[model samples]
Target: MPDIVSKSRSGTLGPAPAARTPRRHTVAVLAFPGISPFHLSVPSLVFGRIGAGGAEASPYRVVICAERPGTLSTPAGFDIVVPAGLEALDGADTVVVPSWERDMPLPEPVRAALRRAHADGARIVGLCLGAWAIAASGLADGREVTTHWSAAAELARAHPAVRVRADTLWSDDGDVITSAGVAAALDCCLHLVRKDHGSRAATELARRLVLAPHRSGSQAQYIPVAVPEALDNDPLEQAMVWARTHLDDPLDLDTWARTALMSRRTFTRRFRDRTGSSPQQWLLHQRVDHARLLLESTDDTMDRIAADTGLGTAVNLRHHFHRLLGTSPAAHRMLFRHPAA
Candidate 1:
């Protein structure tokens, strides 16, 4: 028989098939000089918040380690005392380097410690500007990485060997994981949690945090587009209001355009200009939103929920639900189903 190996949710290596030991993972987050308070807090919060609501199967032990035992100054002008030194990483299963100062080079000792941790089978994570530090250590020479969009071009210019992808929220090249700017660090950490635990655990954590569980790497970082909120005290808003009230009915673009008192072509263009999406897209979003609320608050069947949301069929609902929420209606209901309370 072929050997069966366990795998982490992120598809990383876990344990040998024959190993009977329980998995207890240790995560060591590096708190070097000039680290961002936000970056440091993100990992601490995510890991600490684990096991809060009955999730205790394989908990994480998160420790903050510094280059030396001393007080570190944060960019926010706050001082944090970190007593654990590089030796704190001794038995860590994963090592994380959060955001660091942009222009400063990582100390040689820290570089050596990082390399040693990786060689000892620890996964290395670089968040935001911390990706630069990982690249400085020379381990990410040929790896694909993403940093803050503003810094992506600079990193590429400095290190031609590293394939820099600025748009992605994060990317994992086996042992090394790199994430984009500040808030994306949260997503990256959640990604790690999902990888180590499972989708259910990660989704619960995200619900507590009130964040989307999984946004694809291809999703664009939203840039604020300056546009008028409402072009007129127009009938479009009225039609939208009507659609919300009548989601159970089939609502096509023609119906909405007719209600808006505009030609199909004009309504389509103006709707996109006003809402950044076409009429059909907006209606679909509204329907999905209603379906999600129904899924969470009712014991309605998939077919009934689909009809109630105007998605027409359970199959269509499942398709759009997976595409938008990264999970199916049934799974979502299992996680969030509740009666009106």
Candidate 2:
């Protein structure tokens, strides 16, 4: 059964406000038996202000609830005591379903509670495999959503109506939001905070949490990694880092290959193996992402941002931005721009 079976009478619910004057919102993080500690922590750490408190008004109140009250043990063999049950979904401004086992069947009471929450005008969010649970509730029917790239195939196979986007970090369809994978949950939650409280508030919160404020949802899930775990260090790390810092420079494939100490042919193969994208394509995507940050966080002119990102001309910037993100740079900035800091 489609999880989106619960009808959300409203089109979409934006994030609740954070200003002191507005009413505080209640956020319910749904937990169930044998869930991962990571899944439970993701939402709480993201929304609970788990770290030191911030200067801005609190975003919302977070409550941890289970299908039935009492003890809930994690797959890691730890137990959590909870006082609330399905009734916690009531009066929630937002309901978050963190990752659940993809194979687990949805309970009727949980589905009904989710449906009731939706009908009552609460925003519903599915993080990672939680999307599959959301699908089981029938709320995600015909919605463009994303899950962990590794599981996207299974999700699509299980629910053909879901538009599985394997490339993005998250998907926002107004009232219903879904994220790609484990860590992308952080990215999506921060995005919701940004959307609701403004970039300034989100940035401050991210700094407190030690997270990046923005990683555009449209970006590819595969990223170049060169951490120190491998005894034989990644040959491309230094080069990739250098290239990113020099996006405004005329960095052709030949230049990147030389930086990585490989011939163009060898570099092409190795770069694709590491990042799943050709150097040129990878560079283009990075430039676009950089341009987006400038558009959202600064008031730089299009031509200035273009030159900074090495798109060379405002015309080139617009073309690339539209081709990759399906929106004009001006339009994107207009939609996402936070009040000037």
Candidate 3:
């Protein structure tokens, strides 16, 4: 197994799996003046049901609310009518503050409501510039938080209390979670679903939404350059494809470098440029991802899974799985295994 340390700072393991009579979790997304429509829609799209029958089948009940119940303008050149007020957050299990005007002063009423919700044990999420509101409300003071990189310096200068990381896609400090901009919001929300449900459900939901099943929050929020259009013809891509299929084989950096027709030094630099991770780190993740699929779909023993995924032994598999995913293989299977299996 790889010796990589887990970057997940999120301490809370989501609410325990549903009981015999499960209650739907309530997610309250805050809407404010000049909010982004796409930002406002992320949580709803991730946690809310689509049709009338959708709510009945889904495990979460999502509601949109603002400081006052009325029409609010968005930067998208339109207005959205919010149906609820701060009271909507009173019974919420989670409160999501999406990207908002970072310079705008946090409203006293809104700040108080957020404090009350957090006092009642609600998980508070600040997506992008929403971290400004969280910080201003004193919720994120002394906590490690993150936001869109462009505004990170400003956030730090203004708050002067919270530790800000501009590189991370998201930071989950148990009750308070913050994420980088735009697409990172989607990743954060899906992570909430995965924490609440399990990998299988989150994976299926990602498929339905046409989103990547998972992107570790530790991943760099943005890649500085675009992948070349001719990437398909690159030997690096071919090498990656080959490695995915030959995971069961004992592979090393020398073999991978040779397969890519490059020296180890050149391969290392290019691989990071292309994938934003060291070769070993990327390969470790791939092996763990494959192990997840096996755990979710099959009844194979730990040793069998370990050998098949090239982790070498059952002990190695358990150590790496728990370090990366925060759960044991058996526990994961119990949460995600096919019922028939």
Best by lDDT: 3
Provide the global lDDT of candidate 2 against the true structure. Answer: 0.83
| lDDT, candidate 3, 36-92, per-residue tens | 999999999988742234656778888999998899988788899999999998979
Q: Model 2, stretches more than 4 Å misplaced?
A: 1-21, 50-57, 216-234, 322-328
Q: Give the least accurate 10-residue stretch of model 2, judged by summed lDDT.
A: 1-10
Better of 2 and 3 by TM-score: 2
Which residue pairs clash in candidate 3? none
Residue 39, candidate 1: alpha-carbon lDDT:
92
Which regions in candidate 1 have their CA more than 4 angstroms from the true location? 1-23, 53-58, 217-219, 227-341
Global lDDT scores for all candidate models: 0.80, 0.83, 0.85
> What's the lDDT of the predicted structure labeled candidate 1?
0.80
Task: Single out the weakest 10-residue window by summed lDDT for candidate 1.
Answer: 216-225
Assess the local accuracy of residue 181 in candidate 3 as a C-alpha lDDT between 0 and 100. Answer: 84
Error of 1 at 94 (Å): 1.2
Predicted candidate 1: what Cα RMSD to the true structure? 10.5
Whichever of 1 and 3 has more TM-score, that candidate is: 3
Write candidate 1's Cα lDDT for 1-341 as tens digits. 86667787889976665747566688899997777888998888887786564435437778899998789987797899998999977778888898876788889999999999988999889999889988888889988887887888899988788999875688877699999888888899998887666666777889988888765432232434455567467676777787889889877778778888989999898776656667787778778878877886677889999999999999999999887655888887775543221
